[model samples]
Structures are given as C-alpha cells and as structure tokens.
Target: MATIVKTPAGTWKAVIRKTGWPTNAKTFRTKRDAEDWSRRTEDEMVRGVYIQRSGSERMTLEKALQRYLADVTPTKKPSTRKAETTKAKQLILNLGKYSLAALSAEIIADYRDSRLASTSKHGRPISNNTVRLELALLSHLYTVAIKEWGLGLTFNPVLNIRKPRPGPERDRRLAGDEERRLFAALNDYSNPMLRWIAVIALETVMRSSEITGLRCHQVNLQKRVAFLPDTKNGSPREVPLNETATEAFRDALDNPTRPNDCDLIFFGEPGKDGKRRPYAFTKTWGLLKRKLGMSDFRFHDFRHEGISRYAERGLSAQKLAALSGHKSMQQLKRYTHLRGEDLVRDLDALPKRRPTA
Candidate 1:
C-alpha cells in the first residue's frame, strides 16, 4: 500500500512501507509520477529483486573516485599510483555530477567517445590505451564500492561496456645516424649523468625510473648485476650488465657529482629542506630532443632499442624475458621487432636444402 499526500507547495509525496524491506519515499512534481514510482518500487520489493540503491543514488562518481583514490590507489606501484590518480581526476572532471546509480554503459560510452575526440594538453589526440586505462580505473572503483564499500549497485556499468581498442605496439628503434646525432647532442648537456642515463638505458634495457632509482647498495660491480628492489611490476629483479653498461656504471660511480649525502646514483641538488632526491632529467632530455630536431624520440625508446638489439644477437625468447624483466611473452614480442634486412642477412648465410624423397 502507498500513501500520496499533497504538501503546502502542492508537490505529491509518496511513501511506501513494506515488511522486511526499508521504507522508500520520494517527492514528485506530479501525482501521476509519484504513483508510478511507488507502484514500480512496490513491485520490485514483492519480487525480492529490489536493492536499496540509496547509497548509489546519493554518492556521485566524483565522490566514489575520490574514495577509491584514498583507499585503493596507494596499494599500487608508485608510477601506477600516480598515473591512476591522474586518470581518476580526469574521470571526475568528465562525469562527476552523475550518481553511481545513473552511470550506465551508455553514459560511459559517451565519455569514451568524448575523450577520444578531444586533444590533450600536449596537442596530441588521446590514445585508445589511455582511455582504456581510465575506464579500468572506473571499473575498479565500482567493484570496490559494491564488494567492500556497501554501495548496493545491482551491476557494474563498466563490465558490459565495450572497451576501446589499444593502440598499435610502438616499434621505434634508434638508427645509426640518429643514434650518433643523439649521443653527440647528449654530450653537450651540462649534466654528465644525462649521457650515462642514455648509455645505460641502451645497454641494459632498463626503464628510466629503474635507472634513476638505483641506490649504491643495489649495484654489484664485480657481479655485473644491478638489483631492483622496486620495479614497475612490483617484482624485484636482478638486471645483468653488459660491458657498455658496466663501464657506464663505473663512470657514474667515479663521477665527482656523485653525492655522499644520498644513496641515489643520479642524485639532484638539495631542496629547501636540504633533502636530495633522484635527478629528474626530463626537461634536459626534452631540450636536447628539440635541439636535435628529433621530436619523436622518447627515452623509453632506448629500452625498445636495447631489447631489439639483443634479439638481433640471437638471444632466445626465454633468455630475453629473463634479461628484460618481462613476465609475459606477448609483451616481450612487442619489444622484439627485428628488421627484415637483418633476418634476410642471416638467411643468406644458410645453404639451400634439397627436397626429401
């Protein structure tokens, strides 16, 4: 049974009280709308399929995202945490006002399209991979809210939605002339560590963060191995050093700028509080890129180049995986794009075989 009353403002207030269920009430501008709502709610209650969506209705996506950032984001790796936080902020800006209950697949698809259509601050179009990552964060938020946070969502809106296709794998590797020009330009930079960063990256196939985050205790020059306590995948790995990498590390250790105050090999100057942190060479790298007119070259490309070079030298997939810290063969394959000419050159050395009877 339902009771519909007209208040002083002439709006219809409908209230439904059912046994074994929480009382649901709503104010509507019209009596018919109030009647309709009460009827639907009562029917849902009778069917035992009614979820108390008060939490979902009251909580906006912005609030959910903020809560997720506070609770779940910290558990990820540092780089992942930072990236997810930024993506959460972007989602809030785009769909903050919508309540969790109202976040349907259709609404999420619209957001996906909008993000795809818009250009980023860097004047580049947002990649499908970036959008996919953003959607993943949103999906995780809903999962956490339902399973742990007591938000009674019947289903995750993001689960059914078609995710954007990821962009093609990048196969950019440094050419001989390009490499020469880059190293020549890097030599002109004031920071000697900048050159060492590039050299070690090409030789060891280590990420920029991995290279920068090295502590003196983590390196074993005699063993020619660098121990990474914190990697992007949250797994500790021992990266083997080639002859070039060993020499670069030796020089880095011998450099006069090697700070005694901090354990970081590429230590920056002390801040206002007199704390030294890992040197951030992004700006320096960018300036060097612009000076060399090689705008497409990114520091991460060094990893790609190093891995490809290793594959060219006849390293097996298993061997490459161990050296590169790649857990998945698929990911390793992406980094192992050998040039057709090199393959042909190897094939040319083999003698032609006759058909067997």
Candidate 2:
C-alpha cells in the first residue's frame, strides 16, 4: 500500500511501504502523477524487477566520467590511460549535462552523427576510427557504471546505436627509389636516432613506439633478439633480429650522446620533472616527410613493408605472427601486401610436371 499527502509547498508525495521491501518515496507536482508513479513502482516491486534509479537520475555524465577516471582509468595500461583521458574530455564537452537515466539511444545516435561530420583541429575531416574509439570508451563507461558502480542503468544506449564502419585499410608500400631517397635524407639529418629507428622498423617489423621505447637491457646483440615487455597487443614478444637490425641496435646503444642517467636507448631531453622520457619525434618526422615530398608516407607503413618482405621470402604465417606480435591470421593479412612480380617468380620456380600419358 502507499500513502499520498499534499505538502505545504503544494506538491503531492507518494510513499510506498511493503512488508518485504524497503520504503520507497517520490514527489510529483501533481497528485495524479504521484499516484501513477506509485502504482508503477509497486507493480515493479511485486514483479521483483525494481531498481532504485535515484542516484543515476541525480548524477550527471560529467560527474560519472570524473569518478571513472579516478577509479577505473588507472587500472589500464599507461598508453590506454592517456588515450581514454583525452576521449573523456571530448565526452564531457558534448554530453556531460545529461544524467545517466536521461540519456537515450536517440540522443547518443545524434552525437555519433555529429561527431562523424565534425572536422579535426588540423582541418582534416574526423576519421571513422577516431569516432569509433570514442564511442567504445563511452560504451565501456556505461558497462562499468551499471555493473560495477551500481548506477541502476537498465541498458547501455551506445549498444543500441550503430557504430561507424572501419575506415579503409592502408596499402601504401614504398615505391621504387622512394626508399633510397628517404634513407639518404634520414642519414643526412642532424639526429642519427631517426635513421636508426627507421632502419630497425624496416628490418624487424617492429612498431615505431616499440622501437623508440626500447631500453638498454631490452636488446641483446649477442642473442640477436629484442625483448619487448610491453606492446600494443598487450603481449610481450621477443623479436629476432637480422644482421641489419642487430647492427642498428648496436649503433643506437653505443650512441656518443647517450646520457648516464637515462636507460632509454632513445631518450628525450629532461622534462620539467627532471625525468628523461622516450624520444618524441612526431613533429620532426612530419616536417621531414613534407620536405622529402613524401607527405603521405607514414612511419607505420614500415611495418607493412617489413611484413610483406617476410611473406615474400616464404615465411609461414605462424612465423610472421610470432615476429609481428599479431594474434590473428586475419589481422596479419592486413599487413602483408606481396608484390605480384614476386608471386609470379615463385610460381615460375615450381618444377614442370611430365605430360600426362
């Protein structure tokens, strides 16, 4: 049963007290509304489906995100934590005013459309992958809120909306003479580390971050292996190096400019905290690429080039996956773009069968 009363403020208050349930109450501007809510709530309680949404109704998205950053983001990897913090700022700017209970599928879908249509600060159109990552973060936030934080959200609105399709894969391989010209320019650059990083990536199929973040102890020229304790796929790998890669690692390790206090092979200048971090050369790389008239060439393409070369040399998919740290064959396929001429050459090398008799 429920009790209804009119307060001096002239609002109707409905209070429900059942034998097995905790007391629940709500206030409404109209008595009819109060009676309707009380009936619905009591029915839900009887059905054993009642969830107290008062907290969710009062908590805004901004507050929830703040709590998530403080409580959840720290548990993730450092790179993941940094990326999610950036995405959180965008979510706060766009949807922070809405309460958890107030955000609907329609509202989130509209946000998706607007974000896809928006442009980045660099004047380029926003990429589908960027929006997808942002949406993923939001969806995870909802999942955490409902399951862990007990926010009383019935369902995630993001799950009900369509995610943006993945963008087209890049197949840009080094054209003839482009590689020679690029390396010649790198050798001439004032910084020798850039050339070493580029050479290591081409020879070992290692990612730019993995190569740049290397420590002195991670590489062993004697063993011809580089031990990666952390990688993009969340797996540690020991990348076997060829002669070229081993020599590059040796040169980088024996760098005359190597600092005594820093363990990083490619250490940057001291920061405000007086701590040396991994070298960051994104601006320099971009400027150098533009100057070389290869503005479209990206550092990541070196992984693709290396993987394709390995595939052409008849390496098994299992071996390629081990070297590249790819968990799935399908994902490894994206990095392999074998030249048609090389395939034809292999086809020609097969022994001719005797004519059928």
Candidate 3:
C-alpha cells in the first residue's frame, strides 16, 4: 500500500511499504506526481525489476573512482599498479564531474571522441590503445560499483558507448643484422648488466620488468629455470632457461658486490647509504638505440623476437604458451609468426608419398 500526505511545507510526500521489498519514499511538489511515481515504482517492484537509482544519482563519478582506486588498485601486481593508478587518475580528471546516474552513452561517447583528438606531452596524437584502456577502466568501475559496491547503477554507460578502434598489431621483430648491431651497441654501453639482460630476455622470453625485477633465489642454476613469484597476471609462472640464459645467470651471479639488502640479480651500485636498487637501464637502452639509429625498437621487442624464434623452431602453440607464461592461446597468437624462409623449410620437409599397388 502507498500513503500520500501533504507536509507542513505544502509539498506532497508518497511512501510505499511492501511485504518483501524495502520501503521507498519520495517527495514531489504535487500530490498527482507523487501518486504516479508511487504506482510505477510499486508495479516495477512487484515485477522484480525495481532498481534503486537514488544512490547512484547521489554519487559522483569522482567518488566512485576514488573508492575503486582505494579498494581495487592495490590488488594488482606491482609491475602494473603505478600505471593503472595513473590511468585511473586521468579518467577521474576526464569524467569525474558527472554523477553516476547522469552519465549516458552520449556523454561517454563525447569523452571518447575528445580523448581521441587529444595529444600526449610529446605532441603525438593519443594512441587508440590508450583511449581503449581508459574506457575499459570506466567499464570495470561501473561493474564493480553495481555488483560489489551496491551503487545501484541499473546499467553500465560505458558498455553502451562505442570504443575507439584499436591500432594495428605491432609485428616489429629484430632482423638478423639489426640484432647484431644491437648487441654491438650494447657492448659499447657502460652498464655491464645491459648485455646480459638483453641476452637472457632473448633466451628466456621474459619481459623487461620481469628481467629487471629478478631476484637471486628465484633462479635455480642447476634446474635451469626461474620462478616468477609475481607476474603481471597475478599468477606465478616458472620460466625455463636455455643454455645462453643459464650462462647469463652464471655471469650475473659472479658479481661479488651484488646487493645484500635485496636479492636482485640485476641491481645497480649501492647508493651513498649503501642501498641498492633495481638496475635503471631504460635510459641507457634509449641512448644506445638513438646512437645506433634504431630509435623505433623497444626493450619489449626482445621478448617478441624470442617468442617468434621459438615458434619458427617448430614449437607448438601449447608449448609456446607454457614457455611464455601466456594463459590463453589467443594471447599467444601475437607472437606466433614465421618468416617466409621458415615456412618454406617446413614445406620442403614434407614426406613424399609412395604409390599404392
């Protein structure tokens, strides 16, 4: 049943009390409006389709994003925590002024279009991948608020909005001459660990962060494997080391002055206070690339090259995923490319068939 009454202030208030549903009340300037809203809300509740949007209406996107950052961002891997937090902050700056309930597909689409036309500090147009990531953050925020945080959002606005198209897949691989030139440049660089890290990345198909964050106990020289206790996917994986990678570990371990505070294998010299940190070599890599006139290459391309080489060596998709710590075959597909000559060799190796009598 619903009760309609006029308050002392001369406004009509309607309150609904049901057997199973929570009591809901609202005030309107006129009795008719209150009565109509009561009837529609009662009917929706009886049909089990009532969503209490009042909470969402009262909450701003900024508050929701703040809560998500406080509650969810900490659970991510350390390698990605900083970057995800930065992206979340950027999103707050972009859409935080709107209320959760006021956000619509049109508003989100406008945000997307504006971001696509935006530029980075380098004056380069923002990449589609970056815009896509921002949208993904908003989408996930809405999902968490609706399902876990009880924000009472009826729908995710981000889901209805169209996302920008993703950029072309990066197929940049190291050519043989380029690889030789790269190593030659690495030898000229001052950092001794740079060459070893490069070699191990190629030999083990590990990422730059994984390599730089490596510790002594994680590696077992005898077992020829490295145990990554924490990875970007929040799962532990064991990476097998080839002969070249094992030798690299041996050389890194031979550093008598290795940091005792942290077991980091690839660590820099101790500071004035005698504290060692992970080797800061990204700048060195950039300088070397520029010096060699190979500015387009990135440290990540080493992992791509390693995985591509394994695929060309006739490693099956299943085996490659296990080696590369990829949980899905689809994720593994990005690195499964074979050169024309590699495919030609496989074609030549086909067995000849004998004629049947």
- The model with the greatest lDDT is 2
Query: Higher-TM-score candidate among 1 and 2?
Result: 1
- Which TM-score value belongs to model 1? 0.95
TM-score of 3: 0.84
lDDT of each: 0.90, 0.93, 0.87
Q: Would you estimate the TM-scores of all the predictions?
A: 0.95, 0.93, 0.84
lDDT of 1: 0.90
What ranking emerges by TM-score with the best candidate at the front?
A: 1, 2, 3
* Per-residue accuracy of model 2 over 67-145 as CA lDDT, tens digit each: 9899999988888999999999999999999998898989989999999999989889989899999899989989999
**Quality of model 2 by C-alpha lDDT:** 0.93
User: Which regions of candidate 3 fall more than 4 Å away from where they truly are?
Assistant: 1-50, 269-275, 349-357
Model 2, backbone clash pairs (residues 3+ apart or across chains), number: 0
Q: For candidate 3, which ten residues in a row score worst on lDDT?
A: 253-262
The residue pairs that clash in candidate 2, if any, are: none
Candidate that scores best on TM-score: 1
lDDT of 3 by residue, 1-357 (tens): 799999999999999999988888888999999999999999999899998877898889898888888899888777556877878888888888889999999999998999899999889999999999988988998999889977678788898877889897777888768989999887787666999999999999998888888889889999999999877777889999999999999999887767556789999768899888789888888988998888889988888889999998888888899889889988888766668887888888999778898
Number of clashing pairs per prediction, in order: 0, 0, 0
